[model samples]
Target: MSRIAIVSDIHSNLEALVAVMRDIEAKRVKKIYCLGDLIGYGPNPNEVIDIARDNFEFVIKGNHDEAVAYKIPKRFKRLAAKAAFWTRREIKPRKRPGYREQRVRWQFVHKMPRSEQLGTWLMAHGCPTSNLEYIHDNETALQVFANEMGGSRICFLGHTHVPGIFTMDGGEVHYMEPQDGKRYAVTAERAIINVGSVGQPRDGDPRACWVLARSDGTFSFRRVKYNVDAVAERIYREKGLHTSLGDRLFVGE
Candidate 1:
């Protein structure tokens, strides 16, 4: 139960990812797990995938990951669907100098599991029941704890892009907004933690968000500031990516 770092919803933002990785390294964290959404909504799908493939311990499949890798039905909203489609075209294998490497990266995303269980903890992009499902409230967290957790004490997930802690004790659930760098002890019978988004954070904070979980039953949320303007400019230059995507990064909406 060594300390581990969890990151999610990278959304192909290379600047943010690099910044988070640097912070993780500075903290001397060894094992890193990704909750997914490795691609989509940004300018560097291939580059981001390459880093995840090379560094992460494992990456669970997210809704965007499933859509981009398989070209499945576009179930996302208008803007998200457009980004996924654009990402699909951008990451598709082509006759290039690194064709073999490109194919390997595509396969990595294709083979990602919807969920992974590690000892008493479960890791998923969204929820254990489905990758598309989001646990944004106490009711959803309670339902997941009662039905879907499958006896795990803690469930780590990301998809809402907002970092928070949900604890179920004696059939009552409580939600808390995790403050940056504060380690909250997990004393509840069951808990669900959202590690938040590395690329796109919706908690009104423009900085990247991640979590550091320790073996002592405590975890801390971390925020790292990166060059958002660099990523936004890249998105603006790419005709396939909507400008709204760039604009949201500034406000973290």
Candidate 2:
């Protein structure tokens, strides 16, 4: 049996990453898949990237990753652009020292692919139409589902930051609510699972994030609480980050 642990949207929060890794290790998962946005909106960007390099089994690129590597368009939501710009700054601080190393690391993140398949799952930060598309609900997932998966039966996505699962077959779609503390069976062989965010979770629940455990033909979702207060404190001390970004961690809204 092969067990895989899936995580996404780490956002450079090292504390959260550590907690998630500890928990994932406890489960003894052999493979770990990251759905992208590995850096952004958090402190310790360089350290987090380094750790991902050492640990993650597979990594996919997200819009934020693209923004840091390549020049993202100014037309792509001004607020998002601002966040991505700020994230780049957080990753690569100048004058003090280590700026060059950070720049190189950012380049490494950009090198990540937009989509990839591992085992039976296709991983992408968002819908296949665009790496930035958010898959938050059934209607949206259905619209992008058919086109995104193409030949693959299962597509795992991030970008929504909300943990959810949606399956579409024969033009009919079904929504699976976030699992409750246990691994939910994959049930259908062909399905799409959104692994959710690792650092930033906006699913109304204030836990670190969600992970999918896949073995054979069954998959389960598990939530593990990390040091939210520690991450919040780091964000607060980190200069130039929008205060609201740090504030949202308390409620996980």
Candidate 3:
């Protein structure tokens, strides 16, 4: 593949997922990787899971995926924990005539790995070591950089629902704001890149986000606009999902 498409935190929004898929197809990108969170906090968890399993070449397990596949952890907040529990029950196999087997989707999430290393990059749901941890701030980024064992030159992660780049030069970490289609060089300096969230974004932007990594060691952040209102309405119509999930889609929080 000339470009490897990377996406993460797709919390079951079909509209956003479709939109991102369309963008990826238009770019003629074949190989794709997912940083999990395939289920929870949105409508159509099964559909999202199907897309991730069928399309993405590599997948990393996120906190929500772990919760749904095994047990919900106490680390999740009230709404997130509720959504994870709801999704666990929602993905149960049922007698739907035209639909694919729900058990396959559950199995897909169950088989996800917490981290995967490819070339010079390490893919993870949150960070390299912990899936529940957040690298949104500089302090956390510093710790993550400190824990680096010199195996991977770059770490691609998603959990904070924010798209940005963190570079470590001479033991000092620096954060850079990411823009759509903006490409950055991956040098010998250690770096961590968040591909952002596909279903739910908390970076004050409602657009679906992803990343494109070229063979030349350059990364481009991409965002696509999707129908948030339609997805939000579907979330409201779906049973067991909280209305706040729908509310947050509009604000991207």
TM-score of 2: 0.90
User: Comparing 2 and 3 by TM-score, which wins?
Assistant: 3
Cα lDDT tens digits, model 2, 83-159, are 67777776654666777877667667867988886655677888866786777877887776656676777888888
- Candidate 3 at residue 71, lDDT? 83
- TM-scores for every predicted model: 0.97, 0.90, 0.95
Tens-digit lDDT track of model 1 for 1-253: 5789999999999999999999999888879999989888999999999899889999999989998987556567888888998998888779988889878888898999988999999999889978898899998998999999998999999999999999998899999999999989888898999999999999999999999988787889999999999999999999889999999999998
TM-score (C-alpha) between model 3 and the true structure:
0.95
Indicate the residue-level lDDT of 3 in model 2. Answer: 74
lDDT of 2: 0.76
**Best model per TM-score:** 1
Worst ten in a row by lDDT for model 2: 180-189
Model 2 clash pairs are: 183-220, 184-220
Off by over 4 Å in 3: 94-100
Top-scoring candidate (lDDT): 1
